[model samples]
Structures are given as C-alpha cells and as structure tokens.
Target: MTTTAHAPLLETSRALITSLQEPGGAYPASPTFSAYRGYCWFRDGAFIADGVSSAGEVASPSAFLDWCAGVVEAHRTPIERVVAAAAGGAPVPQEQMLPTRFTMAGTPGADEWWDFQLDGYGTWLWAAAQHAARHGLDVTRWQPAAGLTVDYLLSSWDRPCYDWWEEHAEQVHVSTLGCIVAGLRAAADSGLVTGTRAEAARAGAEAAMAVIHERGVAGGHLTKWLGTDAVDASLAALIGPLGVIESESELAAATIAAIEDQLCTDDGVYRFRADTFYGGGRWPLLSCFLGLAHARAGNTARAGELLDWAAGTATTDGLLPEQVDGQLLAHEYRTEWIDRWGPVATPLLWSHAMVLRLAAELKEDA
Candidate 1:
C-alpha cells in the first residue's frame, strides 16, 4: 500500500469501483464477472460497502465516499417500496429482483439471494461507521445516510433474512452473525443502533455466539456453521473488525489455525468443500483477509508475507480474480468461457479493499 508500490492497485481499484456503480446507489449484484449483471442486491451491497469504505479511506480526493453514501441511500426507498407493495398484496414479481438475491416482505425474491442473508444490513451499517470513525465524522454526508443503514440493521437483526452463504436453511451462520455482532458494536459507538437497537443486537449476538459455542470449537478455530464441524474461508469476516484474536483464547487461536489448515491454500483461502455449488474455488480475496487478520493479531511478518503473496496474485492489469488456481499457477482453472469478463484477469474488490485497509492500518499504527 505504499504510494509507489501500489500505483497499479490504485489505478485498477478506481476503475473497478467505478464499474460497480448502479444508477440508484446500489452496486450490481456482481460485476458482469459472471453471467449476471446490473441487479442491486443486499449482500452485494454489504460487501460493496467494505470496498467502498476502503476507497473512501485510502483513495484520495475521496469522491468514492460520496458515491458510497449514495449506495446505501439507493436501497432505502427501493426496499421500502418493495415492502409496501408486498403488504398491499400486489407484490413485486420475484423476477424483478434482478442480478441476484434479496427480498423485501412480499416483494419478488432477490436475484442471487434465493435464501435469507442477515449480514448485508450489518455489513452496510459497519461500513458507514468505519467511514466516520477512520475519516472525519462527515456528519453532513455520512450521518444521515448511515443513519438509515443503522435503522435497517436494527430492524432486521433479530429476524433472520438469510445467512451470508444465502443458504435458505435456518441453521445459524457465524459469518453473518459475526458481522451483525461487529456492526452492532460499531453502530452503537455512534449511538445509531442503541436503546432497542442495542438490546436487539445484544440478543442477536448472544444467540449467535451461543450457536458458535455449540458449533465452533475452542481449539482456536470455528466450525463454518452451527452443528457441522466443517471449516470455511468466509470466517475472514471475523478479522476485519479490530484486533480480535488473542494468544490466550484457545478458540480464537483454533479458529485462525483451522483457517490455515482447512482453507488456506498456497494461493489463498476458500469457503469450504460445500461451497463448490456456486462454482467456488480457491479465492484471492481470502488471502488478503488472512493477511489482515494476521496484521491485526500482531503478526506483522506473517501479514507482510501474505500481503506479498496477494499482491503477486494480481492480474497483469491488477484486478484480483474471483479465485486462484490451487496450483498457484495463475491460470489453472481460469477458462475464458467461465467468466463473464472473458478471461479478464482482475482483482476482486474485496481483496484489494482489504489490502488497502490493512496498508492504511499499518501506516497509522506505524
């Protein structure tokens, strides 16, 4: 993230950020990186918030923050509109939830979000708080916009929309719940999710943690979901909040250790064995997430090593790919036909954004 070393990262990210935009402030469900394009989604918006916050924090001139504010604002009216329509009995057609997953009451189901996903609102709430805390409190801009996000998350916290994986099944999900936990803490710091909001967050987080206790092991690692002892790369969500992992906490250490053992490939981390249904593979974003976690946990040497690995994986044009080859060859599974961008070797916004955030953190702490 040094100015000169990351010039290509900056240029590439600026463009990707631009490409993610939709007219109404929401991002495309996914960039036409695959078959889908142009649908505004809750989950995508949540992850998008992570990247947009990074751009706002590190990308100079800071136009992206304004763009970021718009992203959340776009969802407010649309979501309410869908809910209102659903209540009126003339629900929006499910087909209308383009791109991917999402649902507002009786509205058409989400494009990609066929199932519930509670974390999208949580992620958005946390993202807004991050912008205010790291940068100046842009009350004029972020407060009003983020306020709505806080409200949305509060309303949705207790009621499960969907887990992060979008598995319609009702099993409690640690990743989504973790975000809700972190998001609640973040929003409360700003007094956004307080009173009833605070109570709901506490109740929800407690339930989720109880689920984690039942599902996750104390060996410093966590089971991907409750009741199944499987591991997943998605837990990278845990590392983003702050210095969470401590040497003394066996469960936390086990969780990180489990990630290294189960998910971390030479190239990067992956969700889990079951995630292949979505064509999941070794993910480039997971590498940076691990790196960020390492950095937060005070393992600078390890963090830097992983950071170098992540940087090296960037496409020639500097975009992060959705996943990397297990062989670490850069082109193992990358078929032009498989991707919508058609062999456009690119970095995922999540990977680059985490990198940028970590770099910023390193500098500030240094």
Candidate 2:
C-alpha cells in the first residue's frame, strides 16, 4: 500500500478531483464544459466520490461528498417526480446513467447520451449505498434515494430507454442491465433500502443476470450482450461489484480469467474486445474495474498488478482518458457532445473515481 513511487499518482489524482468539481459542491457530469446546464449524474456521483475517497486526503472529494449528500437530501421531491413521471406515462428511467438533475430535469442544448441515462439512477443508488457502507455513514442517509432507485429499476428494467451505448433499445444489452444489477445490488447491501426495495433490487439484478447466463454463456465464456456472442470487458462491472460471481460461479471465474488473459494489455488498460468497437481501443474504466474484480474476488496480488498497469495510462495531469492503447499506450479521446460552451472535455468523472477506488485498495493492502 505504501508505494514509494505512488506519491505523484496520489498528488495528481487529488489535483484532478479538485478541478472536476463545480464550485457550489456538485460535479457537472463531465469536465466537458457546456452551455446546456449540466448537473451531477449517477456516473459522476459514483466515481467523483470514489476518486476523492481514494486521494487519501491529499485533496478532498468533499465537493463530491457534499454534492451527493445535498442531492440525496433533496431526494424526496425528485423521487416523487421520478415516480410521477413514470406513472404518468413518462418513460421509466431505463439506465441512461444520469443523476436525477439531468434525467428528470430539462436540458436546453444537446443533452443526449452521457447525462440522461435512466439506468444511471440505479448506479446512483448503488454509489450512495456504497458510499454509506464504505464510510460507515448512516445508511438511512441514502435510503430514500436508494429506495426510489431500486423501485425505478424494477418498475422499468424491462422497458427500454437507452442502452449503455446510449442507443435507444428494446434489445437487451449486457452493459445496461449489468450496471443496473450491480447498482441495485449495491443498494440492497447498503442496509438502507431493504425489504421489498432490497428484494426487488436483488431480483432485478438477478433477473437481468439470468438473461445473460441463460443466453450469454457460450463456448465456456460469458457473452457480452443478450443473444449476441460478444465478449465484452464491460461485463467486468457486474463481476467486479457483485462478488457473487467470483466466489462460486465457474462462469464468473472463467469470464474474468478470459478478460485478463486476453483483453488486459501489458500496461493494464482493457480493450472491450480486441476485435471490435471503436478500433479496439483500450478502456481505462474497464481496466480499473478489472482490478476491482480481482480484488473483490480475493486475488489481491493480481489486482495490484492490474491496477498498476491501469495507473500508467492516466495523464500527468491525472485525467484518465477513455482509452489508452495497450501495445503503444496511445491515448484516445471520446469527445463528449458539443454545447454552447464549445467542444466538450472528456475527463469523465467516472474514470477519476475508478482511480480513487483503486487507491483505497492500496491503503487496505498496506
């Protein structure tokens, strides 16, 4: 945990966390400064706090913490809106991955894809629950948001909003449902949203997962999407967070093992599949989550190595790019949408948080 050389990593990471925040104590979804009135999102909330938590007080993700608490505190109204929106023939938040503000709230300019993910609500639930559990905060602090999130997931999982790729869909994609399941499982475990809500979260996650297992398992590996034989590293999110897959399930073990053996580059970044998508680019978040998958499954040493590799791709400025080419360490930028502000910055809050969570493992292993 006490790496003599990790000082710069910690310092840079802290600096980035400080920069990513809105002055009033919220994250603006992405660093992609925009004119369209951006707000915090499920993805941002999860990772922004994660990054700060990992910075080890070198800097505080407290801006993130304040944002989460404030938003969670305000949950009663939004939850009502969310429920009303769903009940009144509004679309169920299908996991577009936005925080409540952008999801239910209106956006003027281009707000598509990144910020309005309905599945993101589930992630918000998961992150809040995890934040409460990890920090030993009062679980009740997260209950309502967590509860509404779970209810939302169950009420709308089968319906379509947006896939992880942000494409509208009725077709089941692995990333969407997987994230939903992982997030809900987080809510259920948080001890805040229990009983029916917890059961529903657990069930939704399981059901979505069942869809994967029944149809996804093929040739001795977990397939990426339902009915498609794609092998995506994104599945790592489910296996990493749940901890259920790694311990007893042969499929989880084999799937992760396959990812490490094939998808993980020598430098530790993850390519979704070397043969497909965005020129077979390496995904930083997926790589970090791979480390978590290992760690969550009790393979600390392997996790440490993968985390080390993943850390290499982070810029000297501490912003984790969306992709770091494995063989050559090529940095790839996925431009977020344009708005009144101009071209968007892709310093995704999720990537920062992934690094932060990885840093937490360092302390624990120490």
lDDT minimum window of 10 residues, candidate 1: 97-106
Weakest lDDT window of 10 consecutive positions for candidate 2: 330-339
The models' CA-based lDDT, in order, is 0.55, 0.59
The CA lDDT at 289 in model 1 is 71
Per-residue lDDT for 283 in model 1? 62
Q: Write candidate 2's Cα lDDT for 252-278 as tens digits.
A: 788777777767666464545433333
lDDT of 1 by residue, 159-262 (tens): 43445555644556667667766666666666555577556656655665566666554444766665567777767657644322343356655677788877
Relative to the unseen true structure, what is the C-alpha lDDT of residue 49 in candidate 1, on a scale of 0 to 100?
A: 52
The parts of candidate 1 lying over 4 Å away from their true place are 1-4, 18-20, 40-44, 55-115, 138-162, 194-196, 218-220, 242-248, 277-280, 326-347, 364-366
Runs of candidate 2 exceeding 4 Å displacement: 29-39, 54-110, 114-116, 167-170, 242-244, 268-271, 274-280, 325-346, 364-366
